[model samples]
Target chain A: MNDEKTYALKSKRIKWFENPLISEDKVYWKPKRAIWFWLAVLSFAAAFGVNVFIAPLQETQILPYRIFLASAVFLLLSLHAAALRNPFLRAKLYHYCQFIFALGIFLSVWDLLTDKTSVLPVPYFPSAASVLQVMVLDHALILKSALYSLRLFFAGFLTGIVLGVSSGILIGWARQWDYWLSPIIKVSGIIPPVVWIPLALSILPGSFSTGVFLIFAASWFPVASMTANGISSTPKKYFEAAQTFGAQKKYLLFKVAVPHAMPNIFMGILTAAAFSFTTLIVSEMIGAKAGLGFYINWAKAWGAYSKMYAAIVIIALEFSVILLIIGIFRRRVLRWQKGIVK
Target chain B: MTEVLIDIKNVNRIYRDDAGHKIYALRNVNLQILRGEIISFIGPSGCGKTTLLRLLAGLDKPQSGSLSIEGKIIDKPHFERGFIFQQPALFPWNTVEENISAPLKARKIYAENKHKAARYISMMGLAGFEKSYPHELSGGMAQRAAIARALLSEPKVLLLDEPLGALDAFKRSELQNNLIEIWQKTKTTMALVTHDVDEAVYLSSRIAVMTSRPGKISKIINVELGQNRDRNDDGFIALRKEILKELRLASISPQPEYNI
Candidate 1:
């Protein structure tokens, strides 16, 4: 049937019949490189063209926007050139083209509407350039604030994870510990970490430390509860199996129970992270001297909406970066759960 | 072979149903496990072969009487009795080598016995799979690693609770051969709880057949087929048939207490 004569003789040809190209061995032709690079460059070029030709309704920093668009176009071109070396990256760029094109069109519309005409209000709906200006011009201050926030986050998160895991292990294993501590964990976990601001301010000595405590409180409960839940739900057979191995309580907790609860503990951490980040921002806005939260508040008071938007963008960037790192770590730690994990 | 390693005398385990009726998981069970001999407990489901195995493993307590090893009362589980569960039950986070070496590390004797893990790894035919996780392995290979892990600890008595119940027939028979070879090499006394009559006859030296509902041993058949028994042989088939007939009788016996 593979030969053309046999294929012709057959009343109903197979799906691949009448095709000139035949693969002796099963293999596929290489997929063509995606055209995202050209689209991205063209899109950015269009946005840049709109920025240059259009006149603003009021005097605003248009230079930064122009430079940003130009650089974006240049970067896209360079990336396209670089992608020639990496086949995987070429595929990813193809996937990104539509989004990039859409974003470029959106930016052009925004620039024309905000800068060219006061369609959405002059001060309230700042153009993309003004927001980018804050990120580019005030980068040093923004970076400093980010550093302070990250320091607080790490301090709180590490403490919370350490204390949470330990307490969870204790509660899950010991009936007495579960009896005493579970109620407190349940009660305190329900209350928002922001509610502790007043109490933390009064006792914690400084706003920065209070911020840390607030973040810690935010993270600790979910982690602890999840760990406890994970350990508690571990199959009784695991304990019995380990017991037959003369496994001590420590070994049982770590080797048997802890490993079993790991997925749950990870779930808890993800929940805790969402809560912790929100807690950090709120606490910083309330009391901290140098942080993105404080910067956001300061920008709001001065009616610098663009800078406020810039701070939020920075916050989002930080969050995305942290999430990316965590995702990588989780993938590695839970690599054993390759096929089945939801 | 004559020396007794574990003795179970008049052991009883009872559970209360929701309606407050007493369900006898095991009742007045008596058996002696001999040193360096592979003894199997074969019965129908709910016949407490596993319950009896667990008693020997010290994973459960008998309501009455005692379980002892070398004249020492077994009130709690110890490494002296390595228990292989129905499932391989290997730690998912660990690699094959890591799971095998877990026992040595748990005892804080890793420095001295770390080499034993590598030896058992190859002995169990798990040479290239040292770095592979349990989830990555097939059913037979994972069980092989589980067996290797248990054997690494060098227990006086190994308790197996239907360790081959999950595999396909081909894999099951393959592991059966592996088990016989391992037993011969280690000379570690083993107590297997199984429902498969062929498995019981092929692997064990003595078969303790039991009945359900107030589970107790109904008959004990000595399988002296010697080492390297051929499954197609007349003697092997005879013993298998005899055990099957005994099981048929055991299952059909009505509960005397249930009778009005």
Candidate 2:
């Protein structure tokens, strides 16, 4: 069956574009078959080269850097092609990338575990056992740092939403308030939230409070700005309709404006969360005594490069988890907004 | 003669530009609309047809005019007057049911009245699609939903501003009959603004032909045909010809040019 065509407006002309860029319906399989054949051949060559040939050279402890480089190039090429044209292909490629990335991570860990090349390998062949011993010993510190950072992020993020939404409604509904407050809001939003760390520490109770304050500051601007813009742009007809019905101002705000402005408010919150993650790290480095950022700094100071790498990896994983949850919520809240062209 | 429901007299509206140049959108306008009369306002674009409708709906104010409804001066929009615009301005985020019930909900129309008010959902032929959102509906369906929403409030006077002007020919014909049927059933006063002379002739009891920009009432023709008028009849044809000639005359006649 032919794919359904969707119409898009470009200037005065409306043109139909086909969706589902790839499907099982297509007759051409030449490119897919060719790519699969090369993948099979390359896997065999790498397997034979590492296990049969280079197993003996492990007294010198091989790094498998060539395997890493070759696999990375193949994966990147396939992923870029899949994502550029086809949604189904892009989903499949993303899953494959995740699997490949996981496998690469496992191989890197195995290499480090079995090899005898120390990070500080100048005149010393430090064994892999020593590197493993340090990680096992610092496990508790890593867990504590991760939890501390997450706690700060949630505290500041929630507070930012409360302040942003209330202030946004005021600015949006009242012209006098908008005129008076807009310049201040603009000037203050421009100053990076992280710059307030030292000031927060002096005014707040503790180090964690400073990090939380940073999170709040980082998230507040986008939500407030978006809420204000959304409310102001509500169709005048709806407002007038409400007036004809004798709807009170309170009813107008709660019943009409809030729900209408929700999408933009959610967008603001999403951006705030992203900015909070980045600022949380910076704030931890400046003020907090414990966090993922502090652990990385501590590892770096003591020259434990492997531990530093692992901590950074954990931070990335946490951010990914938060992003996934936010994405799911976004889909649910915006379900009604589907099928509308911007 | 019918009961006078709306009365406007000596209405003058002056608009000032950024450089303080004066423009008269309406001048010395007078009109009286009866309880069950269907009135049509026909004029060129920007002849203040829309402005007059807005004023009737209490959405705008006239600089020097007296407007009364049932002999009471109207200063604010009462729920007694309902409006439908050319564009179906249904809220995009709400379903058809929610949009139609909006004014009802605002008035706190009891849960009991909801079932009665909801009868218009099917009366307007949107029964199965009540749950559908505005974006999902066709242009005709969307406009129908808007009309349903306006009627749900049960306004005594309906001010329709080119309500079917945006629809395709087929949809427009279907809706015009439906509008006539609704008008005959409810006997509500309606003032419709449209540029389509044929629509004005078909729907209106009396067609008030408006002159070009800064419009004045040029002629008000009383259509003498029966309620269910025949389109192919000679009498109907003669009335249509006379209107066309008058419209052409208004367009070509060389006369003294005022700012109007």
Q: CA lDDT, every prediction?
A: 0.86, 0.74
lDDT tens readout by residue for model 1, A1-342: 457534433435433222333222123232233555567678778898888887677667777788878887777777768765543344455556777878898999998888778798877888898898878888899999999888999899888988998899889889999999999999999999999898899999998889889988999999999999999999887788777777888899888899888888888888888999999999999988889999999888899898899999999999888878878888888888887665
Q: Which ten residues in a row have the lowest lDDT in candidate 1 chain A?
A: A17-26
Residues B112-211, candidate 2: write the lDDT tens digits: 5778556888988899998888999998999988888888778878889999988999999899998998898888788999988788888888888766
Q: Chain B alone, TM-score of each model?
A: 0.97, 0.93
Please write out the lDDT profile of model 1 over residues B1-260, one tens digit for every residue.
69999889999999887777888999998888899999999988988988888888888899999999999999899999999988998888889999899888888899988889999999999999999989889999999998898898899999999999999999999999999888888898999988889999999999999998989999999998988889999999999999989988977775854532
For model 1, what is the alpha-carbon lDDT of residue A263?
Answer: 88
Off by over 4 Å in 1: A1-36
List ranges where model 2 is wrong by over 4 Å. A1-141, B253-260
